[model samples]
Target: AQSVTQLDSHVSVSEGTPVLLRCNYSSSYSPSLFWYVQHPNKGLQLLLKYTSAATLVKGINGFEAEFKKSETSFHLTKPSAHMSDAAEYFCVVIGFSGTYKYIFGTGTRLKVLA
Candidate 1:
């Protein structure tokens, strides 16, 4: 079975502080991991993806993640959190079989305090 768990349901940070959101995944096969950000009513934007290629992946808006095969974890981080960065983040994993489907983690809502 394939599944993803976000360690935190919500994260609060001051305007210029660092941001960290944790995620863990389990898959039956090689997994393609992804981080997606969703603003209020907007659609999801791809933050980063770890194809079988890179263990350390960088994404847009100063976000990045490191894939740990042994720990089965892929955590998202940013050096600084901006007010504009407040949003909902979803950890996703695409099945290795190329099924074009995704398994989404519950979600982590990020609040950037001004």
Candidate 2:
């Protein structure tokens, strides 16, 4: 069994400041984790992914995440925040235990301040 939780329901950051969105997961085995972003009325876009290959993974834009096995955390971070970054972010996980089951987080809304 696997589940994911987005630590914050909302996150606000100044235009030139750093952004961080925390996510924690509980899985019975090593699972593939992913981060997706959605605009007001747009589709989900793949932000980044963490497989067995690399603990630190980079994705589109300036976003990046580190897979911490010990802490069971995959937090998303960026050096600077942009108004376009305002959206809903979801944490997803899929465990390879005979089935392709996906668990999704509640999501975190990012608000960018001018």
Best by TM-score: 2
Off by more than 4 A, model 2: 95-98
User: What is candidate 2's lDDT per residue for 41-64, written digit by digit as tens?
Assistant: 899999999988899999998999
**Clash pairs, model 1 backbone:** none
Question: Which stretches of candidate 1 lie above 4 Å from their native place?
Answer: 96-98
Query: How well does each candidate superpose onto the true structure, as a TM-score?
Result: 0.94, 0.95
Model 2 clashing residue pairs (backbone): none
Task: Indicate the residue-level lDDT of 67 in model 2.
Answer: 96
| Shift in Å, residue 5, candidate 2 | 0.8
Candidate 1 C-alpha error for residue 52, in Å: 1.1
Residue 87 accuracy (lDDT) in model 1: 96
The whole-model C-alpha lDDT of candidate 1 against the native structure comes to 0.94
